[model samples]
Target: MALMITDECINCDVCEPECPNSAISQGAEIYEIDPNLCTECVGHYDEPQCQQVCPVDCIPHNPDMKETKEELYQKYMIISAA
Candidate 1:
């Protein structure tokens, strides 16, 4: 599944650079994750890089955008090829 930044985000600007797919960005309020560009690091790492580096643990799976690992991998492939 893709990940999302919650309101709990501190806006420390740490998670943005950690995203392999560049899915994280500063929203009107806190940081936001783009479900279309998020692949949960499927093609880049064993784990989600943003989750690992977030100091407040505000990032979590986007329940509304649930997706299988295979689907994430496919998205990663498309992202990588582009």
Candidate 2:
């Protein structure tokens, strides 16, 4: 599944650079994760880098944008090709 940044985000800049897909960005409020560009770091890391580096642990799986691991890998391949 893709990940999302909740309101709990402290606006700490750490997670943005840690995202391999460049999916994290500063939204109107906190940092946001674009589901279209997010592959849960499947093609780059074993786990979500953003979650690891986030000081407040505000990143979590996006229940509304769920996808299997294989699907995530496919998304990763498509993104990498671009």
Number of clashes recorded per candidate: 0, 0
Per-candidate TM vs. native? Answer: 0.97, 0.97
Clashing pairs in 1: none
Model 2 Cα RMSD, 1 decimal: 0.5
Q: Highest lDDT among the candidates is held by which one?
A: 1
lDDT per residue, candidate 1, 1-82, as tens digits? Answer: 9999999999999999999899998999999999999999998999999999999999999999989999999999999999
Cα misplacement distance, residue 60 of candidate 1 (Å): 0.7
Clashing pairs in 2: none
- Model 1 accuracy (lDDT, Cα): 0.94
- TM-score of predicted structure 2: 0.97
Cα RMSDs, all models = 0.5, 0.5
Full-model lDDT for every candidate: 0.94, 0.93
Model 2 poorest ten-residue lDDT run: 12-21
**Model 2: per-residue lDDT, tens digit, 1-82?**
8999999999979999998889999999899999999999998999899989988989989999989999999999999999
